[model samples]
Structures are given as structure tokens and as C-alpha cells.
Target: MMLPGFPEAAPLAGLAGGLLIGLAAALMLLGAGRVTGVSGIVGRAFGINDSGMSWSSAWTFVIGLPLGAFLVATLKGGFEPEFVPLPLLAVAGVLVGFGARLGSGCTSGHGVCGVSRLSQRSLVATATFMIAGIATVAVMGAL
Candidate 1:
């Protein structure tokens, strides 16, 4: 899909974004000995104790995401994606979040970093999630 204002430079923008994300993940791993898995971090933030680290960084990352997006929007004059109704959005978020937890990782963790490391489990999980997402979108469009 073509982004409205980012038409000509979309591919470059995506590559830059992927590079930045890889750099960030690598740095996080190197510096903190932590996997840059948003679901795991967020689970820890909710007092899930799979690790001993304090939830401070997780909280910061979670909070910073939306704040950073807002700042970028202010700087770039970009429009936000349209949301469904609040109730529907809430339900969808809960289900997706649960799925992420149950699957042991989110898309970024599995698709980008894990797959790059040649992890078999992550490869399967990522492929399953991608197919599921595509099928979901197709079904939704058909409805």
C-alpha cells in the first residue's frame, strides 16, 4: 500500500526503518542482555516475573512509543491511522496481546530478530502469524 505523502520514498523509508530497528535491537541486546521483544517487556511491566530486571525500561519503552509517534506526527504532519470504536479496539487489543503472549513473541521479535538468527521455532511461529494475519485481513475485507 502506498502511503499518501511518502509515495516516492517508501521503499527507502522502509529500509531505513528496518535498519534503525535492527540497530536498536542489537544495541539493546548488547547493552542490556535483553531481547527487544515488546510482548515480553510489556508482560514484565505488568509484574510478570520471568526476569529479574525492574519494569522501568519496559514502562519507558511502552510509554515512549506513542509519545514518539506523536512527536513525529507533529514534525512531519502525518495523519494517524483510523481506529475502530473504542470497545472494538479494546477487545481486539486484548485478543492480539494475549496471542502475542501465548505465542511467546510478537512480530518484531519473531519475524525480524529471531528469524535473522535462524531460530526454527521463531521461523514457524512467524510464518504462522503472517499467514493468520493475511487470512484475517482477507476475511475481514470479504465481510
Candidate 2:
């Protein structure tokens, strides 16, 4: 099967984004001594569990997710991503949520923080994640 190719991958933008993410995650770890895991932060914000960070702080981090995106969109003259069908999007979201639960954290948590700490589990989990995403794209394209 011939899969749709994304020849427009923006390497510079991707590198900049990755560096920013690493810087943010590193600052969170060094300054706060907490992993900047979105799921963990958001869960704490909602009082799911008591973590080292304060509830307000956790919520602040959660809010930054969208605010940062908006800031980037504004600077980039608006962000336009390829739109997936709504139904497919919903299903993908559900699957992501389930995967997060099963994995104990979101990709940002394990992929960024955990891997940086040289965690064996995070390395395995990140590998599984990439594999799953590639497989999903392949299967969906085949359909």
C-alpha cells in the first residue's frame, strides 16, 4: 500500500519545538523537582492525588499547554494542521487516553522526562509508543 507521505516535515520548526520542550522539562525538574508530565499535572490539578507540586501550580502548567500553542500560532501567522475526520479524531483520542492509563503517563512524561533520566521503563514505553503510532498510520492508510 502506498501511504500518504508528509514531505513537508519542517525540520527547523521541529528542532526548535523539541529544544523548547527539553528546556521547559529540564527547568521543571531542576526548579520544581517534579516531572512535567501533563497527565500527572492535570490529575493533581483536579485533586486526583496529592503530589509534591501545589494544585494551583499544576493547573498553571496545564493551562500553559494551550496558551503556548496559541502564542506559537500567533507568531507563525496561524497554525493549520491537516484535519482528520471528527469521528476518527474522537476514536483516536479515546485510544490515546486508554494508552495513557495503561502506560501510567502521557508521551511527554515518558518520552521527555523519563527518557532524560535514563529510565529503562521509559525507554521501552517510548519505543512501544512509536511502534504503535507507526502501526496505526499504516493500518489506517491501508483501510
Candidate 3:
């Protein structure tokens, strides 16, 4: 559904996506006994971190991420994704990777699973992420 001021906002779609993410996180935690942290999974997959998660499992999770998004986008008649230049995108990726490593976890781990479990570190990290995101939007808008 469209939001009042944000005419293109899809609340229903957002809700559905959130639910799916939560469900997936819950399943990962319950079934695999692990947090669905993408960064950690990637690190494990690449042999950068040995968190006891299997390489195959980590690869499966990483591959399923984009595969799931692509399936949904295709079902919805596809979408055009805008991107910054390659150099800028690469820089942003590096920055984000560094931040995630420094923070010990990314948004999915901290904001979703950790927060739900009432972890203090996750709460603070999620708050910090929100503030940073807001500041970034404000700065971009001002430019």
C-alpha cells in the first residue's frame, strides 16, 4: 500500500519482506543454531573467519541471498537498479565491510536477531546504524 507522503512506499510489500527475513533468521537460529549474519557467513565461506560454520553452508546462504531477491524481483516483473560508478561502489563496499568487521556484526545480526533477543550490544549498534543512515540521507539531500 502507498504511504501518505511517500507515494511510492509499499507498506504491505515491506511488511511481507520483513516477515520473510524474520522467519528466515528464526529458522537459521533454531535449525542451524547460528545467527544469520551475512558478514560472518561470508567470512566463514572465504576462510577469513573460522567460526565453526561449514564453508558449504556459508556459500549456500550467500548464494541464496541474491537468488531469493532475484526470484522475487522477477516475479514482480523485474526492477531497474541504479548504481553509483564502479569506483564509488567499490569504495562503499570496502567501507561497509570494514564497518561491519569493526562493529562485530552487520544490520541483520544486530538489528534483527540480536535486538529480538534483547542484546545490549545489538541495540546500541542498531541505534548507531539508524543515526548514521539518517545523517547520510540528510547530507545527501542537502547536496
Candidate 4:
């Protein structure tokens, strides 16, 4: 689906975004021997014991995300998303994040890196997430 307010450059923009993401993931794995798993990174942020360098890099990446977006907007220009509501967004974020942790990976981990590695568990988890997302949208549409 076309995102509201994104220019005709959206597809190219998306390609660039995907390329950057893949490059970052590949670089992380090659350089630090770490999987770019958002849930795992967040878990490490919450005091999970792992390699100090990996945890620190994960933390840096997490912190850099918003900053990078801001820089991109400054360079490329874009619309900022309007929130449904702060409280609702916060609650949903917490629930989704917890679910990601419980599922042992986030969308990026399962959808990108894991699938690329041909991991069966990642395939199943990614499928489950996609199905759940579709169902949620359908139910919301009905409501």
C-alpha cells in the first residue's frame, strides 16, 4: 500500500532503506558476530547478560534510529506520523514489544536475517506474525 504523503519517490526510498538495513545487519554479523535482532537487543538493554560489545552496539543502534530518521528528514524531507493517541500508542507498543520478546525475535530478526539464513523457526515465527498482523487489520476494519 502507498503510504499517505510519501512522494512518488517512495519505492526508491524504500529500496534505499532496505539496502541500508541489510548492509547494517551484514556488517554487524561480519564485524561483531551479532544478529540484528531487535528483541534480543532490547532484552540486552534490560540487563540480559551477553557480550559487552554486542550489547553496547545494540544500544547504540537503538539510540541512533531516531537520530538517523531526523537526519533523513532534514536531508530528504517527509511527513511526521500523526499518532492515534499517546496512551494508546504507548500501551500497544509495550504489548507488541513484549510479544516480540516472547516470540524470541522481532519482525526484522525473523523476516530479514532469520529468513535469509533459512531458519525453520524464523520462517514459522515470521508467518505467525504476518498472519496475526493481517487478522488484526481485518478485525479492526470490521470494527
Candidate 5:
């Protein structure tokens, strides 16, 4: 299951990335009073019509995601994540969108910021998603 062009796992790298994500999310919340939820950001950017951030700002944030990734990949020589078939990826993306709608926010909003704020609803939503994710992995492994 090793991805091409990628070295072995680097827990330090993962930790640094997580820390950076937390810092970014924290900055978005504390600085602009906005949630750093990428799904909502992208949804609004593409005219899904949420009422918080302006299209310009949201679009910038969305564009920054891939651009930042590319920058990191370039700095590190390259990047390769394990590939999934396009059809399955599409289905999974759709399901994730549906779930995000149902849950009111993605992991960034609920899992990081909301949970940090000790929000009861976000706590429940985060737990539900985590459990569902674990169960889904178990079922998939069985399959």
C-alpha cells in the first residue's frame, strides 16, 4: 500500500502538519471570527451560498489549499498519496458532502474549533463522525 515517490511514515512531519492546521484554524476563528471549515468554504466559493465569508475571501482560502500543498510538495521534492479509483473517490466525496451538511460542519469547524470551544453540539457531531469513520473502516476491512 506504499504510495509511489513517498518515503516511510514520518510522525514528526504529521505532527507538524497537525500543529500548523490547528494554528491556522485558531487564527481564522480568533482573528476573523470565522470557522476554518474547508467544505463550507469551497461550497460557498462554488455558489453553494452560505452566509458567512464573502466569495472573494472564501475563494482565496480554497485556492490557498492546493497552492499551499503544491508549495510544500515542491519544497519536499514531490508528494504522493495513496490513490483511489476515481469512481470510488467521487462517491466518497458525495457522501462526505452529504454528511457535512447533515452534521452542520466538517472536522475543522466541529472537531478542531468547536470542540476546542467546548460546544455540546460540535462534541456530539464530532464523536458521531469519528465512530462512523471507525465503523466504516472496520466494515471495509471485512469486505
Candidate 6:
């Protein structure tokens, strides 16, 4: 449903998505005894790191992310999303990868799992992520 002040906001859809994400994260942790960390899983899938998880399993999870999105978009008759140029996307991806490595875990891992467990590092990392995101938006808007 649309939000009052935000014409394009779909609160129900967002809530449903959030619930699904939480359920998936919880299932991943309980069923596999692993945090749903995309970056680490991607690394493992690519043989960049050994995390005791099977390569095929990691790859399946990584692939499912976009596949799920595609399914949803298709079911909804698709949407036109404006994306930056390939070069900018490549640069952004590299920077995000570097940041995830430096931070020891990505948002899903630290923010969702670790924070749920009340880990200090995850709390700090999540705060840092939020702050950086806000600052980036402010700066970009000002430009």
C-alpha cells in the first residue's frame, strides 16, 4: 500500500519483504548453522575462501538472490529501474567488496545475524554502515 507522504512507498510490500528476509536469515542460521552473509558465501562459492560450506550450496544461495528478484519483478509485470553505467557499477562493486572485506562481514551477516545476537562488533559495524550511507546520500544530493 502507498504511504501518505511518500507517493511511491509500498509499506505492505516492504513489510512482507522484510519478513521474508528475516525468515530466510533465520532459516539459514538454524538449518545450516551459518550466517547469511552474501559476501562470504560468494567468496566461498568462487573458491576465494574456505568456510566449511559446500561450493554448490554457496553458489545456489548466491544465484537465488537475483533469481528471486527476477521472479518477483516478472510476476509484477516488471519495472524499469535506472542504473548507472557499467564502469560506475564496476567501481562501486569493487569498493563495496573492499569495504565488506575490511569490515569482516557484510550487512546481512553483521547487521542481521550478529546484531540479533547482541554482538558489539555487529552493532558498531551496522551503525557505521548507516552513518556512511546517510552521509553519502547527503553529499550526493548536495552535488
**TM-scores for candidates 1 onward, in order:** 0.84, 0.82, 0.90, 0.82, 0.83, 0.90
- Across 1-143, the per-residue lDDT of candidate 5 in tens digits comes to 65576656765688899999999998988887898888888898999968488999998998899899999988988877789999999999999899888988898889988898899999999999899889999999799
Worst 10 residues of 3 by lDDT: 1-10
lDDT of each: 0.83, 0.86, 0.90, 0.82, 0.88, 0.90
Off by over 4 Å in 2: 1-9, 80-94
Model 1 lDDT at residue 99: 87
List the candidate 4 regions with Cα displacement exceeding 4 Å.
1-6, 48-55, 78-84, 141-143
RMSD of every prediction: 2.5, 3.6, 2.2, 2.6, 3.5, 2.3
In model 5, where do residues sit more than 4 Å from their true spots? Answer: 1-9, 80-86
Candidate 3: tens digits of C-alpha lDDT, residues 1-143? 55467636477778889999999999999998998888899989989897568999999988998999999889988989887899999999899899999999999999998899999999999999999999999999899
lDDT of 6 by residue, 1-143 (tens): 55467746477778889899899999998899998888899999999887678999999999999999999999988979888999999999999899999999899888888899999999999999999999999999799
The C-alpha stretches of model 1 lying farther than 4 A from their native spots are 1-6, 78-83, 140-143
lDDT of 1 by residue, 35-93 (tens): 78878777788886554446888888788878977887788887768868999989988
Model 2, span 46-129: residue lDDT tens: 897666799889989988899989998889788777789999999987887778878988899999999989999889999999
Candidate 4 vs 5: which has more lDDT: 5
Candidate 3: pairs in clash: none
* Distance from true location, Cα of 65 in model 2, Å: 0.7
Better of 1 and 2 by lDDT: 2
On the 0 to 100 scale, the lDDT of residue 79 in model 1 is: 78
